[model samples]
Target: MSDNKKLSYCFDVDGANFTSAGEASVKVKKRLREAGFDPETIRRVSIAMYEGEINMVIHAGGGKAEVVIEEDRIVIILTDEGPGIADIDQAMQEGFSTAPDNIRSLGFGAGMGLPNMKRYTDEMVIDSRLGKGTKITMTVYV
Candidate 1:
C-alpha cells in the first residue's frame, strides 16, 4: 500500500491446454486473499476472471490477461487473437454461445461466460472484430 502504487499481474491463457484453463484465476484468487481483499470481492473477481479465461480457451485458442489492483477497484483485461465475436449483443445473452458441440460435451461452453463475467464485475467492456480478435475489460469495485 506504500506510495499508492498499484499491484499488477499478468497471465498467459493457453487455449491449447484445457487442463490449465483456470490456473490464472486461481493464482489471482490466492493473491487477492493474501492482499486482504474481502471474501465477497475475492469471489467476484475470481469468478469473472475464470469465465473470461474459459472464453479465451474455448473460443479464441489462447489469450493474455492482466489484473491490476488499485485503491478502489480490481481491473481485469483479457485479449485474444481468435476469430472475433460477430455479435456482442447476441453473445451477451444468457444462452447464446458459439462454442462447438465438442466443447459443450466437456461440460463447458454453456453460453454463460460473458454473462457471468459481466454479472460479477461492476463494469465490463468488450472490443471485438469479426476477422481479428477480442479484448474484454472488466472492473470490480473494492
Candidate 2:
C-alpha cells in the first residue's frame, strides 16, 4: 500500500442475530493481518471493535461500524439509532450493563462491553442523545 493511502471499511451489524455479532471484528482482524500489522495492534483493534459491535447489537438493536486504517493509528466508529444511553458515566463503569435477561442468557451482556472497549483502545469517545442514538469513536495507535 502507498504511504499516503488510507483504507476504510464499513459493516452493517445485525442486532437480531446474536450468532453473527462479531463478524465485523473478525473481518477487521483479517484485514489488519493481511496488511501486516503487528499482532498486538491487531488484537487491540479487534477486541475493541468486537466489544463495540456487541454493544451495538445488545443495546442499539443494530448499527454501522466503520474502520479507518492510517499510518499511525486505526480508528473505529460505531453509530446506532436505537434508544440512547441515558448515563454515559454509568455505562462506562465496569460490570454495568442494561442488557435484557434473554441476551444475558446467551453468555453475553455481562456489563463489561463498554469497559472492555475502553480498555482495548488507546482512546475512546462516546456521544449519545437520549431517545435518539449513540456514536462511539475509538482509536488504537499502531
**In terms of TM-score, which candidate is strongest?**
1
Question: lDDT of each structure?
Answer: 0.94, 0.93
Best model per lDDT: 1
* True-vs-predicted CA distance for residue 91, candidate 1, Å: 0.2
How far is each candidate from the true structure, as Cα RMSD in Å? 1.0, 1.1
lDDT of 2 by residue, 75-116 (tens): 999999989999999988888889999989989888888998
The per-residue C-alpha lDDT of model 2 at residue 134 equals: 96
Candidate 2, lDDT over the whole model: 0.93
Which residue pairs does candidate 1 place in steric collision? none
- Evaluate candidate 1 by giving its C-alpha RMSD to the native, one decimal: 1.0
Residue-wise C-alpha lDDT for candidate 1, range 20-139, written one tens digit per residue: 999999999999999999999999999999999999999889999999999899999999999999889999999998899999998989899899999999999999998799999999
